[model samples]
Target: MNSLYWGEGGRFGPFDEQEDGWPNAGQVMRYFREKSNLSAETFALLYSKELEKAGKQNKRGQVTATWILNMEKQNLIPLDMERRRIIARLLHIPPVLLGLATLEAVTIQSRKKKPMGTLQKVTIDLAKHQKSIRDALHIHRTSSAKNLMQDVERDIWTLKDIEAQVRGDLLYQIQELLLSNFLLATRIMKDQRNYPAAYRSANEAVRVARQTQDNDLIATALYTRGCIKAEWARRGTVFNGMFQLDTGKMKSAAKDFQGVLQLEQETSIHPQLAGFTRLQLSRALAMLKLGPRDAKVAQALTMVDDAADAIDADPVEDFYIRALITGTLTGLHAGGYHLGRSETLNAAGLPGQALAELNQVRQLRQGKTYSGDETRYQAWFDLLMSETYMNLGDYPEATARAKNALVTFHQIHSPRNMASIKDIQSRLALSSYGTSIDVKELNDMLQEWYKPE
Candidate 1:
């Protein structure tokens, strides 16, 4: 396969810390500064001035220009993790990238034609890199974090931290990390169009939560698992870029939600958590009504109403729970809209409601009050809003919302979202009217329904 296609230029070489020296965060700072066309001393001056503005003196109550330079040279500045993260953000580089002592290089090479029965070589190289990363992760898992080399040390440390805290006071941290990983894996699988993997990861998250002995963790995991199950059922575990709906997946999702509800009944979990989980379950079941069964749809609607009642009984200041509810509600709205149930639209205000929910999400982000999973959950809401507006024949609105979603999507590195937005833009471009679907747009979407695998 490697012979079938060309590879990129670059050699895979070791990143030597002692030889190359620790990464000068300041050098990176300088790189971003140059990229932004700012003076080298601008940031240093800004920091100094900001210190003065805060009624504090510089290191010697003097100019910080040389001090900044010294810090850059020694790679000893950015005294705090948050500060380092901020600098990384300002520089438009990943925090992880900045710590890299040496970059792994890959160079593309031209393909040479061979005899018949040969596969492409380019694909092989790409596979090799992916396998390498996965293999590294596996190896790191078996070793102690302190014993591991720097390259794998960070991941090893985090994994060990998660493991060490899973049964202790840091159980919350474990649940949070597992939840984030589960969500990340879910998005990845969805992007690769691999539903089975997404479902498996989601289930694994639930299992981890159970081990944590945290009711909040357990319930939240179940809620998220239900969502993934619903998504799989709605879209089918198989995909070919078509929107062919699958009822079996929805039923499976519904079953998962039921499992959540059953657990809620048995455990003394937080009321808010239980309420939110039941709400999610209702949303999953609601999706099942997309079939011709009117009775089932009615029952699903009642379940949703019942969940809503329960939510009203729960506390409102719980930001995490609110984030979860918003997500589940958005899903319900989407499922209802697709099922051609007028009542679904009436019961839910379509994407318009989702847009309002995103405002709350924005508040959550600004407040810096949410954990990583909640942040991603809010981001998903933003994506939902963009998609909803797009579906309602509002191209400009859709495009703007899509752009916001793209920013968050890139941060999270979800390929599935990137692809979905690309398809949406293409549809918008081919439409005669900028807003609203004409016959052509409808035809294009329908074509997607029958796209080949």
Candidate 2:
């Protein structure tokens, strides 16, 4: 065996004697390309002409592939915003991922001591961008929302350098901008399933909002944090079979929701916001796994009814708000209220009434335009239908609905719902065949769906 030097004082013989050092951007690019089984020549051939047509040709008229080699070897590093943007687009990654400033950041950096009037204009523009981002989210255009948030993040970072130079209303404007950025970042992070990052961003939003003493902004931040906690708690539950609650996490989530409600009561902002908060609190309470007769469950149902009436009376006209209310109502009818009623009826030997309540949820879901809400609503609807059919002894329909729910859950990237559907399928199989079915194959499939990137 040949010896080669590895890290400090570590060696294998001659074969391993190749140089070891930190790879530059170019080297990293080459390494990744080669690892992907792409030859430099082939990679160049693929993108060179496009780069040339895009006018990214170097002084020697070499294309982007040549530039990549130059970048790898530390001979050239593109600093122009256009070049960086082109490269990032070609690579399908952010410019920051390539250790380059985004175009927005670069533009902001080029400005020196921007006038307050200009900043005010910028603030207004940023607010408009935020609204656009919200619109994207409303339409379930997650990638667009994320890209907009990233732009906002870059602009905020660029402004931070000049924070001390600004004063008075300008400083306040800057603070509000920072607050919005953090809050938006929190939302995008949560959507992407990066819960920890979302929580951190929400906390930052709260800190900044508190500095401004803005009750609305603070409430928004608190509401966001509370939602994150509730989701985390929900994910912690053993979702297979019946919903087995994780009491500790559920309690923590309940406390977060209660805190938000308390803040709202103290400050008294938008009545709709209060309704929204109460809706979430109701959801948390409903999912506590208490029996139907539990006072808490009844209270949760009351909260849901109250929130729904409030939301309907005010009419927010926001897609997400409407979807959320619809979703919550579906949940309340399917499991929170109706499911509890069904369980109680089943326990009382009244299977027919139990099935009727479950069917009511299906009726409610019908004739509603799901649109962008398809994945979520479909999963819930199908799962509830499956359970209802099973209770009614309609095994075939139960099996089909369970499978459909599984597929919908997969589409939505919901491991918990997938697990629940699998459980239901297993129960259906056992009921029909007098033997439990093996779910090893389904488990393997779900493992692939949830595998860490």
RMSD of each: 19.4, 20.0
Q: Candidate 2 local accuracy as lDDT?
A: 0.53
Off by over 4 Å in 2: 1-124, 135-188, 237-244, 289-294, 318-369, 372-375, 383-399, 412-453
lDDT tens per residue, model 2, 1-453: 211211111111111111222113454355446546766666666566666787776666545455567665762446576765665565553234344522111121234543321211111233453454356454333122454556767756754653544443445555666766676676666655566787888788778767777666666666667777776565434433434446676677678668767876787545555666676777677666356666766676577556544433444465433322222222222233454444434433345766786666555554332333545554665776666667778776776677677666666555545656655655654575324233444444546654422
Model 1 misplaced regions, further than 4 Å: 1-195, 207-218, 234-242, 291-293, 305-382, 426-453
RMSD (CA, Å), candidate 2 to true, equals 20.0
Question: Per-residue lDDT of 1-453 in model 1, one digit per residue for the tens?
Answer: 131111111111111232333334555455555667766477667665555665554556654566766766676655555555555665565454354223332222233333432211111122332233344333322221122234333432454453542222233443445454454455446544467877887787677777776665666667677777666654443333334446676666666667667767887545544545555555555544545354655665565455444433443453333333332222222222222222233224344544544454445432233334443444545556656666567766766665665556555544555555555555566555445444244335334532323
Give the candidate number with the greatest TM-score.
Answer: 2
Give the candidate number with the greatest lDDT: 2
* Model 1 score (lDDT): 0.48
